[model samples]
Target: MSTIESRETSAISGDAGLSLIELIIYILLSSLLLSAMAVVLVNSWSTQKDVASVTQATNRGQVIGSAIERAMRNALDFDVDDATGTELRVRTSLGGNLACQAFLLKDGDARFTTSSGALPTLASDWARWENGIAQYASTPFFVENGDVVTYTFDIETDSAPVRFSGEAAARSTATGVSSPCW
Candidate 1:
């Protein structure tokens, strides 16, 4: 064995993997990194949940508002048989007789119901019945001049309630195309 070989052997033997402090430091650093990642993940999840709630609430509100507005606006002709606080019977050019109204379900959830043609037909003529809607706390829907319906809507959401108020006037001036349906 030469001097160089002996020195190499000693160096190799003296080599150790890691000191205790180095191992502990590495563990602590990794723990801190994992904690940071966990915090970020939790915050991201919370923000996403909040955004979803707002989006759902906004969508519901828009649907309810637009449906009523469109029901009054888009009619080639319409008749207002009964328009009240919690009930509306407006036969539009779209939904025929026995069409639409706002009422509470058996479980107390308020909603709108609309049908395409008269009932007793085959394919479910119900266009779309948006649920989770309520009359506004202060003032509900009321009729003006027997053709314009003014309403305040309350949309139920998981976080909080949303409200919208507007007045919709029927564009119809037809004489007696069809008798009004309830």
Candidate 2:
């Protein structure tokens, strides 16, 4: 009878704490949720980075291209040895009295030469060339004297490519001498 009474008392007692198995299961579920969230966050970050790089590269490329175009359009003097061939000399205005010259060369590839002390600065994801042709970072800006100036900006990073080649066109003091060659 006493044993029966003790058993009844034990059964009546409510559960006070979680069992080891329950605790373990809870921990595992929480860990799994956290891990999944981490993965999602990492993936988002990676995609964002890629997008940023591409944008930067493109902007850089545009700047270099625009600079070349402006120079070509503003050229006070120009010389085209042969239209069939890709070599020309152009003279244009620089900052203030400083004159800027550029030579364009377009063969199978393209390159350019500039008078600027520093090369063109693209958006921010490409390389700048002091001389010689580089891989087409951006489209060819212009062609003169077998030299090509191409500007490329990085799409994914903050780097740009400004490519210069050969010697810039010679600047002439003559303001309005309408000659075939300046």
Candidate 3:
């Protein structure tokens, strides 16, 4: 064969395949890249779960806060039931003899019960948090002075507990009237 042909054949044979060391190095690099990617994916998923937990807790807090504020605003008179500060009894003129009682259940849920007429019996839960995901960290309480009523409580969640507070004024000037449902 010609010298040129021999040189060409030698070059082709030399460049035909990768060395064992080069192959091993490539595999290691690929494995490293995959590991990094997996870590990043895991971290992202964890962050998402945390965000969702917080959002759910916040929404639940808002709902409970709004309900309490509405009840307080419509109340002609109200009483806080126990030293634990978990119970509130509100009487509204709009509902006639009907009254609302908000209390914390044994399972850490907050609920409302409404009753009307003389010799009133226990009623169904008006607003209940029974999902078992969110709970009351502290008993809810009210601070009343003159015509203003303030409600405050803490709701517990997986990530962090949220504090909810709100104030409402009575629609009528009549205060200290005896509640029929008492």
Candidate 4:
């Protein structure tokens, strides 16, 4: 074969495939890129999970806070128990005989119970943190100054603890009304 033709053929063959070292380098680079992508994916998932947890905690706090505020605003008379200072007794305007008690259960469940008779039935679970992992960091309490009442509480979750506080004004006209507390 001619020298020029032989040289061209050799060059083409040499360039046809990667050497062992080049192949190893390529594989290393590809693995690094995949690893980076995997790290980014894991970080993104972690961030999303944190955001969802915070949002859920905030929603629960808002729901419970709003309910307590609404009930307090429509209440005739409300008192925080002197014994534990965690139990709030409220006489609601729904009826002169209707009364509600808000307290934290032994297992950290915040509950609301209404009674007009001998037995006080569980009306609702205001905040349920009874699974042990999640719980009420602080039981709800009320600070009453004349007609204005302030409520404050905290709920602990996996991500963080959520705090809630609000002020409500009792119905002035409903004052001095009698309600049954069982």
Candidate 5:
């Protein structure tokens, strides 16, 4: 009976507290697991940011490119505004006699706005198609071959640049002078 009691007491004490080695091992393993999780979280965040940037650039490039193509395909008259081919104006079949649509690249951004019979005199009239364009990667220009017109644009992202190319034809030539919209 005495031996049995001593054994029971020893068993209870053995289960009461962890040895120092056991405690230290548990702490070390927990710290290692937590640090690994933190690293995974940081990597996931960086990948998400890059994906968002690329998506934004691609969406902007596609929307702007398609709009220009559509306008040219149904254009009543088309003209380039400047010698550098940076500005293009289209008088669409749907537009009023004194209205036009202007597309241009300025200050490293692709911009668009409506105009009266002539182009707007103030730069404030223009609005950006999207936010934050890399100036070095952008080259928005027009190339007209007879009735067919071609446009090209390069939209820059953090990873790679998106290139847009479109070609279309106008219904007729301009009835008046060059820079007809202006």
Candidate 6:
């Protein structure tokens, strides 16, 4: 073959294959990019999970708080455990004086019952009344008063242990009487 042709052939062959140095660089870059992507993905997943848990706990707290407030506003008489504030009893004016009691367990669950041992409806997903105890694992909610009757709700879930709290005030059904909603 002509020297030019031979040289051209060798050049083409050499260009077709990667050298060891080029291969090593390519591998290192691939590894670094993959590691970066993996870190980002892991962080994103953890944050999303935390947000979901917090959102769920917040929603549960709101529903439970609303239900309790409604029941209390209409209550003829009420009793709360002073020691723990984890239990509540209410005598309501609805119909023929409905007596209800709620017990909150430390496991982040709750149960409610009528006076005669009848199971009350589950107002939300966080609580279930089985046998006689309402169980849950989390922090507690407390009542606060202002111009309107205000209460705070706080809750936590297994995945996210941070407490979520909010204030809710009652809305007065009639004028002159202030409601908490404001």
lDDT of 4 by residue, 20-117 (tens): 99999999999999999999999999888888877777787677667667777777667665565555667777653345545442334566555554
Off by over 4 Å in 6: 96-99, 103-109, 116-153, 158-182
Per-residue lDDT for 170 in model 3? Answer: 71
lDDT of 3 at 65: 70
- Give all TM-scores, in the order shown: 0.62, 0.50, 0.78, 0.79, 0.77, 0.64
List candidate 2 stretches off by more than 4 Å.
1-14, 77-89, 93-98, 103-182
Residue-level lDDT of model 6, residues 1-182, one tens digit each, is 99999999999999998999999999999999999999999999988988887777667665666666666666544544456655555554444324344434334455554442332434342246422122223333343333222333335554645443334333433133211111
- What are the runs in model 4 whose C-alpha is more than 4 Å off? 95-107, 118-140
lDDT of 3 by residue, 30-140 (tens): 999999999999999988988887788789877767766676677777766446555566676656434544544334566666666432334243556544323244534
For model 5, the stretches where C-alpha displacement exceeds 4 angstroms are 121-125, 134-140, 171-180
> What TM-score does model 5 achieve against the real structure?
0.77
**Count of residue pairs whose backbone atoms collide, per candidate:** 0, 36, 0, 0, 0, 15
- Per-residue CA lDDT of model 5 for 40-102, tens digit only, reads 999999899889988988888788878787777767777764466667777775556435777
TM-score winner: 4
lDDT for every model?
0.58, 0.47, 0.65, 0.63, 0.72, 0.52
**What number of backbone clashes does candidate 5 have, counting pairs of residues 3 or more apart or in separate chains?**
0
lDDT for each residue of candidate 2 in 124-165, tens digit (9 for 90 to 100): 222232222344443343334423222222222423443333
How far is each candidate from the true structure, as Cα RMSD in Å? 5.8, 9.1, 3.5, 3.8, 3.2, 7.7
RMSD of 3: 3.5
